[model samples]
Target chain A: MPPFKDLFKGKQKYVTVKPTSIQTEQPDGLWTKCTQCGQLTYTRELAHNLLVCHKCGFHFKLSAAQRLAITLDEGSFVEFDSNLVSADPIEFPGYAAKLEKTRQATGLEEAVVTGQGTIGGYPVMIGVMDFSFIGASMGSVVGEKVARLFERATRQHVPVVMFCASGGARMQEGVLSLMQMAKTSAACARLSEAGVLYVSVLTNPTTAGVLASFASLGDIIIAEPGALVGFTGQRVIEETIRQKLPPGFQSAEFVLEHGMIDMIVERRDMKKTLASLLALHERRHEAG
Target chain B: MINLTLDFEKPLVELEKRIEELRNFSREKEIDLSEEIATLEKKAEMLRREIFDNLTPWQRVQIARHPRRPTTLDYIGLIFDDFIELHGDRVFRDDGAIVGGIASLGGRPVTVVGTQKGRDTKENLARNFGMPHPEGYRKALRLMKQAEKFHRPVVSFVDVVGAYPGVEAEERGQGQIIARNIEQISRLATCIVVVITGEGGSGGALAIGVGDRLLMLENAYFSVISPEGCAAILWKDGSRAQEAADVLKLTAPDMKRLGIVDEVLPEPLGAAHKDREGMARIIKDALIRSIDELSGIPPRRLVERRYVRLRRIGEFMIREAAQEGFAEAASAGGDVLRATGPAGPKGEAKR
Candidate 1:
């Protein structure tokens, strides 16, 4: 078994922590309740469905490696900047220790894993963010990796696909974390100028700084079914506006309805969907 | 009286109130409390120093967001003369959260931009609590572009919690505008100076915050997220914001040490709220110094320097070993010399 699956074995931190509420905690073990539709799901069966509950089509968070496995062709991922670790720029208290704990738990040096991979024989650059790693916050290393991924993809004359699953910008890194939003967005702008097809796949809980920048700058934005995507939390907005938000206000369906995202693809069809996008782009390239 | 004193400043507030009461009593009763008042005044001054000097990161945050703290318009009014306020983004309705205009600073024509917040609840709603929408950023960028075109320096005041997260703001692409500002501002072919007069939260602060010389007031804060947000996300408890602030290192001194800020402009004795004009004068001097130093450089050189300054932000590996004197001194010294050595002017001379 892959380390990612093993990481989930006998422990399920992902299921317990929902983005919307701190009070909501799922019961431990094989049985889990979906926060969205409140469906009782068998954990094993849910994993087989790419962590999506079959009853409600709510996507569960996946580790970066798990995402790469499902999206890329077999044995195609060649990870870049794997050893680029984070530094305590401000020597932020307990940050290094917290980072070490997360590294041990997730087997990721940073929140994001950037690599070159093939999807249905189409070569591309890919980055997958693991929400398990410190809520997949974009710090300096994540920014550097994502920026490098785009630069490499543009240079290689191939498409780019990124799986975004973040809580927000990493607060521990202070201003450095916020700078990533600009850095990644600027990198995306360069990629756009190069005329490369960039597909951003928003997973469960893409919010704040990541959602406000490159995640929203994709040539084609695709969100997993029921993925939460927004610049800020519902609670924060509600506090500001002093009104109750609509149900699923920042959900994938809501974003699609609001014309922010291009489409919502299920886990079962994501690989095929990406392959078709690559093929279409190739045909367009030829025609042009 | 309705006092909005911070937790740490409560003792000082009490001292001041006692002093006030004693003064009134002395005036009304014709009693001599001069000796008592002198003693209390000295104690109050010392207490103020102690409290401010040893302020925790969270305390600094409170001061930065103080209700009486001078806002962008206050700074503009005090620093620049003959200001002509500009409006509208042209692409969308003018976002009042951010206000900018052409202004004169020490006889030099420059463009000034800043995030505007309100003093009270009604005005806060009108300005979106100083949180700008996409149009706000676009308007600032438009003004900045105009500054670049006219060969005028751009000065911006950064004081925001974050970009507005309203449904309308998101629908209009808030992310794109902030992102574009950072990108364009980095390559803008003119001198740029940014002053953080208050809260500098996340990309909202960063949108108009990047410049050749980023100056932050003594009590100002610039962070990726509000301490409350950080606390809520990290500890699952927003009440632990004080603890989060300590860990965030968002204070101006912390930012200066990290090279995120070029300089830390001194605020008044109590805070910026105590003396607005004094704080503004310090900011004006810093801006003038930055502009004068940068104005002589060619546009291309200015842009390159700004790019290098931004690119050099944040810390990474190899500091520990170097600090331990693991590397040879000769090589390290040579590397620093090479890195800081001037290349542009000498190359031109050679050509």
Candidate 2:
């Protein structure tokens, strides 16, 4: 009764039921897929590893709070400029709404969180950038906060450590964003003049205005492994040169090869590495 | 003799052409048409004023990018004397994109550094289309530091599309070099003046842009990113650059209003490209005035004032509840954070 094709189709429908285990959903926030190696990892394990992929060593971006938590001594952080927020300086379209939504979603007043904390028992002033909040762009508020951090550090004669992770100047703030480059750089100049040890740590994706300002002015510039650190973005460079970029272009390894950074440190070793550097530059007061 | 004509400048060009035609016609025919010629000349003058006086931000951007626009070299030749060309960053080969040396302004020795643009195709290639590399910025920093050492006022002229965005530029540490320049120049221990002569594009322009006084030419623009770059990033269309320029607030008046630039020097009737020498003379005068004004302050105070000027540049807000506590703490810290006060006199930041 069946033609050759119809006979095969009827036979294939005999076992259509699927297994229930594959269809059941796992609890949310329990697992994270590796962006580099495509490996499913327990979120708790990932956090314990400081958000670095255990399988492929991909250093995931960290929020300001998360960065502060892992880098500082337990319960030693005191935040500054927590009430500062951005204003629509240029009145760029949708900027206010974007800032509002980002503030709510990230629960942050600005992209960079300035504070005081001890690293490996060495007291230091610190500023950590949260890339999730608008690429940690250096808008007016970000600039003011960074400048204040350096100023405070300079006055207190404390070593300053900064975790720079930005996509450059915020476009919505217009030229005000551009001036932040000068503003922050001026502060770095003051810090250097005061002989304060400024350690700038470049995390994943530090480029453009931020890179060309305080991020690059560090006394010892250290970058995390596999971080994209450069003045220009890859897409912009590709378009300008009209060619595909080689793999690892603008990565921390590439930058180290080019002699831009002092060293490349892994996420887990960052705290110990920074503590030693701060200890080496620790100020000693003469006994009266 | 401008080789490039922009869309907005077309009407003024047409009016001037009509006036020229009338003059030629009268001379050729040996007719008494002086009155008609005079009338056309008056109309052309008014049209020129009308076009230049009320230029839109996008129009100013066009003028800034005009190929015939006067270059830094041209201004140096016209305004300064005894200009000895300097070269090389010592670590790298001399970059043609930036030109710098010691020169005399009105018999006062000053160090001059400027981003150079070429006049023609071959020159543009050599100049890398006015885009500096790491070496160029390094050379600039070297020259500026020398100026500081010699107690010479550093006068820098800026006109660049951006820092070069090529693979080689990236590999050579363009970002670090620029960062070094900005930091070193900020507390340079000498009076410094910066003039934005044309398109000041992003961090590239800012590599040599910080100073005690920032002066912008009438049609020149200074932006964090180029309008085309912003448009492509935000609108996903590079052609929407005109719209982006409007929103960037990059015009000279915008800079003045924002308290970023100290002064906006007026240009010739048809912009700098139309009257290069006149524009140079105006810039020369402004440079003299700025340098004189800045030279009066001692070096330490100059650096401190420079710090304060830069410190007060940004705009931000404080929540109403946090304002009082912030004000008291910031006042104790000093005037650096006084700009953070809510409803301050600058009125830059609002609740």
Give the least accurate 10-residue stretch of model 2 chain B, judged by summed lDDT.
Answer: B342-351
Consecutive 10-residue window with the lowest summed lDDT within model 1 chain B: B342-351
lDDT string, candidate 1, A203-227, tens digits: 8767777887778778899999877
TM agreement with the true structure for every prediction: 0.81, 0.90
Per-model lDDT: 0.77, 0.83
* Top of the candidates by TM-score: 2
**Hey, what RMSD does candidate 2 come out at?**
9.9
Clash count, predicted structure 2: 0
B70 in model 1: Cα distance from truth in Å?
Answer: 1.0
DockQ for all models, in order? 0.12, 0.24
